[model samples]
Every structure is written in C-alpha cells, then in structure tokens.
Target: MAGHDMLRSISRTFKLPEELFSGMPRIEINGDEEVTVENHKGILMYEDEQIQINGGNAVVQIRGRGLRLCTMTRTILTIRGYITGVEFLR
Candidate 1:
C-alpha cells in the first residue's frame, strides 16, 4: 500500500486520536553519529548507537544502545536513534 495509506491504517488500528496523527514524525540521521526524530506526538531519543527493525502494529523499533519514547497525546510516538528501518504492520 501507499505510505500514507499504510500510516492511516496503522493509526486506525491503534485507535489513535485524530489530532495525534496530524503531523508526521520527522526522522533525521546524522552520518554515524546519532539519529533525531521529531514532530511526533511521542518522542524517543538514544545516543551513540544504531537501530534496526522488522515490523510492528503501533510500535517503532530501534536497534541502538537503548531508546527513549515520549508521547505527548498518549497516541503519537517519536523515536530517535540509529534507525535502520521503519515498518507499519497489522
């Protein structure tokens, strides 16, 4: 499916509020340093590490040292790390 469609589907399945998913998460990678994720209802940050993922329903995975996730609306999630993959699944 399309990326937007996929996001919508995941949002619906997770029962996320409308306002929560209004903005897409901003994922930034800085060479081999650190990754930054912003604009999400929730935020997760990790330092000096790598991230990898397979898939999930409403969870974003990171394969670094560790991670910090914060949710502003208790719905949206922001994850920051050495992200390698982001998958939205059922």
Candidate 2:
C-alpha cells in the first residue's frame, strides 16, 4: 500500500478524526450559500462556473453562479454565494 493509504488505515484504526491528524480534505457546507474547506492544499482553478481546490487525496470542485471566495488561509478556504454543486475528483 502507498504511504497515504497506510496513514489512512492507521488514522481509522485509532478511532481518530482523520482531519485532525491527516492532511485529508474536509468540507463543510452551510446551506447553499457558504462553504468551508479544511486542509486545502491550494486553489487550482477559480471561475464563476467552477472552482477547484487541491487537497491531500482528492481535489474539491465547486460549481455555481456568482461564486466568490470569502477567504483563504494556509489550511482553510471559505467560499460564499450560490452553491449549485460540489464534487470530489481523485
């Protein structure tokens, strides 16, 4: 197994929330207006139609109209506006 997979196994075995110890991405959506992404590596793409964020194991893509970036930090990203869809691309 890859190192990442092994880490995941260990994280699960310990009954720990992976997001705390792992770099795996965690996303929180508040209704259809706001979104918070944790452990985001970086923003790969951004536009009105779509926004792509790089995470540890997967990339998060948000689709919507009038999408706006509320804030971004080294480990977090916040988005605001009408969120039409969300997807994970591995």
Cα lDDT of candidate 1 equals: 0.44
State every prediction's TM-score relative to the real structure: 0.34, 0.89
Candidate 2 vs. truth: CA RMSD? 1.4
Question: Clash totals for all models, in order?
Answer: 8, 0
Runs of candidate 1 with Cα error greater than 4 angstroms are 1-22, 43-58, 66-90
Q: Compared with the true structure, what per-residue lDDT tens digits does model 1 show for residues 1-90? A: 476676677778899853345344445556533444444333333344533222222333455544443333343334443445444333
Q: What does candidate 2's lDDT look like per residue over 14-83, in tens digits?
A: 9988887667789999999999999999999999778999976788999998899989999888999899
Cα lDDT for residue 66, candidate 2: 89
Which lDDT values do the candidates have, in the order given? 0.44, 0.89
C-alpha displacement of 7 in model 2, angstroms?
1.2
Instruction: Specify the highest-lDDT model's number.
Output: 2
Q: Following a full C-alpha superposition, what root-mean-square deviation does model 1 have from the true structure?
A: 8.5
